[model samples]
Target: MSPGPRLPRRTLLKASAALALPWLLGRCGLPENEEGLRLDPDGILDLPEGFRYRILERRGDRMSDGFRVPGQPDGMGCFAGPPGSNTLVLMRNHELEPGQDSLSPYTQDQGRPAQAYRPADNSPGGVSRVVVDATSFERVSSNLVLVGSSRNCAGGASPWGWLTCEESVTEGHGYVFLCDPLADSLQDAVRIPALGKMNHEAAVVDPTSFIAYLTEDRSDGCFYRFVPESPGERLGLESRGRLQALRIEAEPRRDMNAGVEPGATFRADWVDLPRPGAEDDSLRAQGAARGAALFRRGEGLFFHEGSVYFCATTGGPESGGQIWRYTPEGLQGGMLQLLAQSRDRGVLDMPDNLCVAPWGDVVMAEDGADPRWPDEHLRILTPSGQVKNLARNAMGGGELAGVCLSPDGRALFVNMQGDGMTLVITGPFQQYTGTGL
Candidate 1:
């Protein structure tokens, strides 16, 4: 009959500060790999000492709805079920294109809907929902939620529901769609063109401010934010708002691809764009003309404590990756800091989707492609700036995506993009010590 305890803002802020201290000290303790990675007998994944994983959903498994599981799972969010229930509702995105007919529900004979967002095209990209019993790690049901989109790459979870974004800029595509994980049918999916049309990757919203920050996954990308006219109202609908791009103060059109020193803070402002839904894919170009700072492939985005953290997958001089933190100053300004950059492939390679762990660590999924290290990894970046491998891909070199934690922090869920598998890892998560900040 009572609600769960909530983390106070002050406590979260303190925890964030503690996590940043290690970076400020300029001395991150090396990752603890004493036991090394335990080879997985299943030949799927390699984990550290006390961790193990289960294959919750595979590419072609039959779902509770009689439809086969879609392939190329990307961004995902976990929502706690009704009060006191151990169930969790997960909305997962599929980075499928038009030709992946065999793996999509739309292309399947029996599960095809009467209509889709794009009724004529029959694009195989959309979102799927899965209900799981957290305590047992058993899947309750899986069904199609959104349909007829292209490359549903990465999306963000909102206090209200799920915001799935398309990573395509085709004339009729490249929009954000809001899906209710609780919805029983596809009729509820609504396209939110107000979020702007571009190569969208993922998004995160500030609960307190009601402001949504998005990432664009292009070689030349611009960091963006959507300020809804009314906070907490249905975004893109009743909460119509202005879409803007971030610009570094006194550094017009600065190319962040060269990388910046860690802890280097830059005053930043948002530049308003007149037409966010332009079909020409010139949104970033228009923002660039107005001095918007450009990033090299912006990917994962998350709002934590009082700051927004995101990754530029191929941003550094080495073309490895970069993570940046943006702390809002007030209504019109903010302070941007280069949190970390990958100078070597061994340390961090092409960081992709990331999430703030329940225990205050930043869990990053590496999408790196280096022949030297044939496999990819699930890396943990402690507040103290130390990076450690938590899990490695034994299933070839498929890039990991959709790294999120269960509501209770007991289960960590992730996806192997290339293999079309969703994995749930459970372990002595709280006992592991991160590099002290």
Candidate 2:
């Protein structure tokens, strides 16, 4: 395979034009100022162009409730509610194994999910809902939504209007649960098993169809789709339907045995994942078994305009992280196509949570193990596949997980698991008309 495109210094200079103009004009304007800020083509945090970043909420900031921000916060979504009352829901994935670092929100009230029915000690997982002051851009009311799981990773919002945070694994009660933001019933967290049980990372639901798409977070992780046979069934209740995985029948030997990098383009023939609670011993090989061959080490998935977008956390000798686009109208009538692969472009050093901007732009969060990438960072790629950094960890280099744009497209809510605080990026983020945002 051909080597992916490299990020050259000249291209970086071209991409930085928006930031360079103000710096150049400052020399000629009033007093000599070295700092002047402006919005770049890449969707970075908007500030006073000249004024530098001021960290508002750090890892150990004390909250009004006396509970501090927890361990590395991951996948989060920002919803635009009433004026001055924006709700920011975050999934703080406690990336703990059997024995590792302790999870966050140290107090008793902060320890468990807002409601935990299937309880367990020494293991707790959940999400936090924080109110963001739209005008002042402050962190307001934040609380836990789920609890008592492990390695909770990136999840997605449902067609039914609740956030589904996926547990990276499914041992114990590490299952996918629906979080009804408006529910005041105080019901214990409800886990949806029809979605299949494994190492899950995120979920994408088709509002029109209510079919929930899911991604697994392991190297052998499987990609699944829970198709509600009813298509309009209510959540929580199990529906009669099938969970199918993608199997490459034509190139089983090549695809099953081809342990190198995937083909230049991603093309998967759909197969079926056995219904959960079935016999584990299979009759076929790993490659020919019922599964999703779209990509290995799957991480995040989002659905848009009849197409599914996903990211592969790892796979390949050199191409560890990649983003693949699967459109139903492909070779198999309903197949997966590699519309764009970060490995092909050398952009995604390590990609995690994903979201689509209002303008059809794909925003990816970087969850790199090694600090930050020189050119690879939280990025925005256009439909044409041109990629640019939206935000780099020049300020902080933690695995940037769970990224979502506000419904109004005003701000981008991001999580740096290692950083511990759900950072909100909004300011004079205006498009600046002619000035830029």
Candidate 3:
């Protein structure tokens, strides 16, 4: 059968009438409680009034492929299945590392396949595909799609498939792997080494330029972009690319983590990294020496409209977090803007994975470390500079990750990483009037 029609990428700047009006008010005040988050009686997740959640999949559950659901779920993406059908496909990441409990679909007793990235290593850090019925919110099936990797922390979605990245630099690891979510069986894993080998966090692609932007989870990480040798070509077995790091045109080696105010705009350029996948793991250091700007703990990234939005999980003067916007200016380079910074833990504490809501606002998942962080929330940043609570975690401070909305915007899907649970939230989401930035 032919593949389903692909879902159109959501625009980053498109806002609904409801959100556009309130945004015009400009942070004057928050909306009433009737439209605010409501407490959850289950003591797990608290959402706004009229909103409810259902656990779609839990770790340890036996999947259709006979393998148990892996733990430590991280980044994910939603895709449309068979054309004009309610079928939806979700590619989820399992953030497992070496020496951890074995959750891999393959067991040593079962004998590893020669195609595995590291057959000798048992820790199963990879991606899984979950098929669901969007109309009824029923799970059709779940199965392991990619395996035999390490610490598959977070990744992004492309026009063609899911891009899963490793968070380790272990010789054969620390590379990005692409997985087709609609496939019936696991395909041979292929690593895109040209994307650089570091503590990979997340990535997003600009469909127009076929340029992929990636983030590294290191404290001194440098933002990077991969320019494929053949622009707009499907990145596969025959593809080769050039990796480059970001640099501020005026302040080449500026420390973006310090002394930068909101709304500060910087002209940016790319510095070519002659050796991205070097075994020495000196990608960041080499790029820095070549005038690339540095970021503190680069984390989640998403592409919307013509710009790329990303977060620095442990940035800001207070060591809270920061969100930045980069808009490409064609061949003239691009512009980077600091959209928001966490000045206090109450506002946004260690923001992690993020996504653009259907209404155009940015929704962030908090990875706060405080003991009281369980009360941390999924924060929404309005275009008018107002930050408001969208949902709160009542489940013992499990860092929220992989926040994405269904293609039709009827349901919002997110993961509670610590508990290895995926949730589907539905309700009066459209009533939200916060103007998106």
Candidate 4:
């Protein structure tokens, strides 16, 4: 099938305006240089004055490949479209576990794909690809690109494709899988076991070193990286590599959950692990026993400007959240800094997925730990250690996931996980984000 035609810029604007009207007044009490988030009348996402959003895709929506869009959309990575095409491709994860057939990518008649991993168990977790026009921001096409993984959570964009992580340690389930953003059909579920196999949350390949940094979703999880004997071997990450965990050079087994203050830096180094694909879930334990530093719960991971930034949900003094930065000195040594930590749940809670915006600041999606207050938000952490509100889940309650941006930096894409909605937010992004982070 052919891709959708791109809509004219004026036409797209007119259509968007008809869907969402301007908020005459109100402010989020933001910084003087930033605009306040206007309450969304649609009660979905509240954005700043000039920003508007388009619901690009949702659960149960039929795709170009005949399969239905799965629910629980989690992590996402944006890629430049094929060759000279004026579009961006989104490789998005659906975090469905077994027995979620109702929210699976397939219908009763459709069933699981022949290439699905763990077909008997019918694990309904995978990644989908969506093409959007760069100018209009309308979806050109959508399809399932990877299937049969469990709890496909947050992942990072790599030069070759998307590094989707499965946040599950069930039998034969937890591993990172690569998905091509440009593939129009379901691809084979090839697991990169060398990346490790225990509650994998996210993975990001360093463009400079081609070494992949990974995050685990355990309370005692260890930050890991897989160094391929040969960099840029493409998808051959599982082929002859050393899987290692991060260790504090000065302090061994430093527990980050004790709450490290923002801006505190430490010398960091990597310690090689015994077996990344061990039958039991002992990878973190092995690393911990070997003097590797421990994080609360590693979630989203992003590499920007020579530094790797990752979120630790349920971390910090109050177990609110923590964001850490690992700046690689070489491939083996680096400096680890506590970039930000939430002391109050009301301000910034359980930062899950994050990406460095084109103009600099880090955009974060909160998976709030407070069950009493279900409101989650999308926040921006500036380079100077200031955290500001950017958007909120006006849709009642749902953790914002898959926070990413178009290559041209014109649109920001994120997923309302519980609501299973993918939104494209467009506005004067650069005007508010050039501060650098």
lDDT (0 to 1) per candidate: 0.80, 0.53, 0.77, 0.81
Error of 4 at 200 (Å): 0.4
State the weakest 10-residue window (summed lDDT) of model 4.
11-20
Best by TM-score: 1
lDDT of 2 by residue, 317-370 (tens): 344466555555432335544433333323456677888766566677866654
Determine which window of 10 residues in candidate 3 has minimal summed lDDT.
Answer: 10-19
Query: Residue 275 in model 4: shift from native, Å?
Result: 2.3
Clashes of 2: 15
**In model 3, what are the clashing residue pairs, if there are any?**
383-435
Question: With candidate 4 superimposed using the best TM-score fit, by how many Å does residue 287's alpha carbon deviate from the native?
Answer: 0.4
Higher lDDT: candidate 3 or 4?
A: 4
What would the per-residue lDDT of candidate 4 be over residues 1-437, giving only the tens digit for each residue?
A: 12111212210000000001111111112232223667787778888767899999989999999999999999999998888998889999999998888899887688667888778877888999999998999999999988888999988977788989988888988888888877989988767878878998999998889999999999999999989888888764446788999999888999988746555678999999987779698999989988999998999999887888898998888788887878888766988877666666666668999998756667989899587546788888654344566788877768899999876677899999999999999988756654632
* Candidate 1: regions farther than 4 A off: 1-22, 30-35, 106-108, 237-239, 435-437
TM-scores vs. true structure, each candidate? 0.91, 0.74, 0.89, 0.90
Ranking by TM-score: 1, 4, 3, 2
Q: Where does candidate 1 clash, by residue pair?
A: 19-383
Which scores higher on TM-score, 1 or 2?
1
Of the candidates numbered 2 and 3, which has the greater TM-score value? 3
Q: For candidate 1, lDDT tens digit of each residue in 1-437? A: 12111212110011122334345434444433323567787778888778889888998888776667899999998888766777898889999878788878743466457647775676888998888897987788888788888899999987778889999988689988888878655654588878888999988788999899999999999999999888888775445788999999889899987647566678999999988768889889988999999999999988788888899999886787888889898989888888777766656779999988755678889898787656788877776555566788887878999998987778889999899899899886656644332
Off by over 4 Å in 2: 1-68, 80-102, 108-114, 134-136, 166-170, 183-187, 248-269, 278-288, 291-294, 329-333, 343-347, 370-376, 427-437
| Model 3 misplaced regions, further than 4 Å | 1-35, 102-115, 435-437
In the order shown, the candidates' Cα RMSDs to the true structure are 7.0, 8.7, 7.4, 9.4
